[model samples]
Target: MARGCLLAGARLVDPAAGRDGAFDVRIAGDRVAEVAPSLDPAGAGVVDCRGLVLAPGFVDLHTHLREPGREDEETVESGSRAAALGGYTAVCAMANSEPVADSGAVVEQVWTLGRAAGLVDVFPVGAITVGLAGRALAELGEMAGSAARVGFFSDDGRCLQDSGLMRRALEYARVFDAIVANHAEDSALAEGWQMNEGEVSSVLGLAGLPAEAEEVIVARDLALARLTGARLHVPHVSTAGTVELIRVAKRRGVRVTAEATPHHLTLTEEAARGYDPVFKVAPPLRAREDVEALRAGLADGTIDCVATDHAPHAPEEKDREWDAAPCGMLGLETALAVLLTELVPGHLALARLVEAMSAAPARARALADHGGPVAAGRPANLVVFDPEALWTVDAAGLASRSRNTPFGGRELRGKVVHTIHDGRFTVRDGRVADGKG
Candidate 1:
């Protein structure tokens, strides 16, 4: 529970070092002091990690903890609990909160609440536009100077479509050494679209969200990134063409990174055929071919990271008719399981999974404290998981404040057993610790 060496004995998989073996990891006072075979279990808290896979704690580049303004939906506390249960040690809380994390004061407030929550590290992201209005650039430098150390600026859940505004924002954010994270949807092209436009939408009589809506924005943003010579990160990129665009940009030496959500890699537009809003997400799930392409991208390193995009909504809001309901699904709690069950077995290896979930996001968000080789003196944020454990997802029993999981009742392989955050046992044996640290 406190300062001590913890011998986590499972299949230790530190993808950053390409180390995978049945080893022991020792943590001393919030830092990994040793990681090797058979450390003496003498005077340490030997957490029996039998049948588990010990790895670095996950880092999410995209998460919507709708606090400050929409506590009715979620708060930093509830969302942090969800993150802990999901084996995450840190998450980049999005800027699209109630008052919006545009100014330094609001962003600092969000950081304070996250620290108080004491579950996982919540890095506050600053808004790309004031009030997320897409009109004027937010105070990027002020936010970066705040306690939050804001490194990501976004107009997420909405695109910063005003080309001039976007250019200026990229230029301004560069001054703070921050990146502009775009939602990448053309408002005019994606208006009123509920789910991915395709044969399924036509069959269900639902409005379709054409892939071009996302593709067009991604193309424009890449061009802007090249022009401004500023770093850009495209969040929740769901289409194959978008991945190709990012690949080309990287080849051209544009400082850009892109992330794909678990839903985009596993589920498809076919899931929306039943008119279930749970399957509704921004950049709605695409076709099976798109999912395959994304998996290929992850395997080949074309896609940089796998973010949760963990959006939570209250039951009342999510239970409405498909078109009337808010978009998003509970992902933090189920992302790893979905990956292991849906992707790893056939398409990707466990090492690739760890990289996508941890190192890549850490690099993308510039959180140097996270994602690493389990070496001496590194921060002791780690996760021990039972890769062989199979379980069914229960939305009602989740740690999240809201039950909007689309994978409810779905059987999945692999599960997290113990999550160590900053050397604290936030979750032990698949349960959260009793008190807030």
Candidate 2:
């Protein structure tokens, strides 16, 4: 796609530079050319961002793009479109794809398809263990050398239970400067679980996935990180105890960081009281106290980022009974709105939100061209959002291949109006733009 010009008029928020202002931003050749109170509208395409808030495009640290297999659920093309529509310029596509991205060949294939999609920068996260079985480590070094430049590895939806194997994986990954991300669930304790192990699950007669299931794994991972002096990241940590554990570990200088999902930050397991599969997710949502603690942690800078955990499922897959249904919810489009309406209103600043959504995730994933200060030399990945714009989420209207969003019919306060990836408007006027290339 050829690049030209764009003047995004709204509150420009760039967390990396600590900048916030109502400025007109100009783009030229896939990089931010100038940002000021006013730019010469000389022959440039003018975009009326009257009520929008322009910021660096979001970067999701965790996303499940079920491709290479399970294309019926989601493919790189469809998932990339979903990311673009959700205001993400980049997303770390989980390695649990079809055929499992456990080798260099598979990883490179995913990377190529993602680029061809031309909607988002999809970084392929390599599996921590081959087949994500938690028994043997995958070819981390080889995958890291592939086109994807894999830096993050995870066994998401499965726990790395063997301490020796995990230690070895971490030790080996460090050689290539890769970080190991754990799903943080003790399979032994969480066996037969469906929702959060609490009063809600008990009341609903659903098998409870205990909080200790997460806490124990978190505590163990921190110890391993401390021992190996290797970088570790915990994904979608849902319990308050896990938050305090990470806080203390960071205090003690353990090389550990953690992320919380939007659902965990806002909705509790109580939202699953009706056995709605939309709320079903791995590391199921927890109690209200946990939600408050997660909010406090994000506000206080203990939690490193807020990831979507954007797991997509076909309608038939999620339409089953609670126990028979698959875990996960569509998150890309609803994440920002949930953050704006639920977090910002309670003292979380817009800058903090940007950090959690973009800057931090970029740093965590080690992506060179994303997250942003929006300078003259950086890649022009940006999003124009109408922060005050109110709209109802109609799952039927989303760009993802699936309509499993938990926010269906809910009125959200913020909406993404335009998303530019590599200087091309992948999403314009709140709709997915056809591929420019």
Candidate 1 residue lDDT tens string, 97-180: 989999999999999999999889999989989999988888888999988989899989888889898989889888877888
User: Which window of ten consecutive residues has the lowest lDDT sum in model 1?
Assistant: 1-10
TM-scores of the candidates are: 0.97, 0.97
Backbone clash count for every predicted candidate, in the order shown: 2, 0
- Give residue 356's error in model 1 in angstroms: 0.6
lDDT of 2 by residue, 350-402 (tens): 77898889888888777778878887778899998887889899899777778
RMSD of each: 1.4, 1.6
Residue 76, candidate 2: Cα error in Å is 0.7
Clashing pairs in 1: 53-385, 69-98
Alpha carbon deviation, residue 78, candidate 2 (Å) = 0.6
Estimate candidate 1's alpha-carbon lDDT, on a 0 to 1 scale: 0.88
